[model samples]
Target: MSVNEIDEQGLGPQARRSEATKRALLDAALADMEATGEASIRITKILQESGVTNGSLYHHFGSREGLVQAAIAERFLGSVTKGLAVFAHRVGEVGSTEQLFEVFRDELVRIGSPDVQTQRIHRMTALAAALPRADLLERIIADQGRYFDGAADSLARLQEHGFIRFDVDVRAFAAWFLGLSLSRLLSDIDPQLNPDNEWSEYTFRALVAILTPAPSAH
Candidate 1:
């Protein structure tokens, strides 16, 4: 069952209300970060925007840093995971390597698009913030493991159908794909350096080469 279902089934009225307040505070925190374009949010502003009490914030999150971490996990990372799920579902429907390549090519374009770039920036900012906090970093690592595992499962299905090389590790390939996509951040900082077409073609070629099965000797 989903988190929301559990919340509804298990929580008392007061507990549900508290959860609502927590949600409000998290929403306010994320909104403030997005508006300011900064990962470090002001607790006072969040409390004001959320109409949640300072004591309540401390009671729920323990500290401002805790609130920020939770916000990043729930909003920024959550968005990335949701997008991955959709992409994985699309991958599962592909009937051939050519169709899979088309799916990936479209994904490459989508990832470098302005909207996805903004999302990537937000997620990277969250990761940067989490780097200094061991607990947050651990949480992020665990989340990423699950995300990559789901992606690997999708790729495994393609492998079973002879659409991908049997020798390749799908989990590692998933991680590599993520790294390649995130590397666009280097170009993102420069306005004059749009290497979308070149990057996509090169990466797609590499992907095809890596996934194509070797010929068997007669």
Candidate 2:
């Protein structure tokens, strides 16, 4: 069932109120983290910003660490999910391999842009934070699974339309594409290694070579 459906059918009024309080705390925590560039947020500050009680914070999230982790998962993974969904939609709309490659080239340029690179760095930072915590890591893994599955489905559709190579494993290709996008983080940190155009051109060429189907053997 959908989250809204579950909220409406499974939760009582008090539970819904509690969920709202939890959301408020998460939003406050995420905002503070973003503003301060700190992963660990002060509980008192979060309580003040959220207008929720300390007791409510512990009751909802168990601890300040729990609250921060939840906030990271909510914001970072949620952003990735939304991004993948949009890309999947774009992939579905293309009528030919050239159009697909055009969309991908556009995505490469867009992601390599300064603003999006900052977002990508934030995602990597969030991922690092999640790595030590088992629960958070599991959440990240689950979200990534969804991302891969969604992208693979889109690629499979394109393959059916003869846009992608028949021999390619759509799931593996999806993972590779995501890895390529995230690889920009290496350049993001270095001042002397700005190869935006060269990187995009190389990546686009690699994708074209990998995705293009071979001629029929007569």
The lDDT per prediction is 0.84, 0.83
Tens-place lDDT per residue, model 2, 38-74, is 5458888888999999998998889888888888888
Q: How accurate is candidate 2 locally (lDDT)?
A: 0.83
- Across 164-212, the per-residue lDDT of candidate 1 in tens digits comes to 8998999999989887887788877877876586778888999999998
lDDT, model 1, position 133 = 83
**What TM-score does prediction 2 earn?**
0.88
Off by over 4 Å in 2: 1-16, 35-40
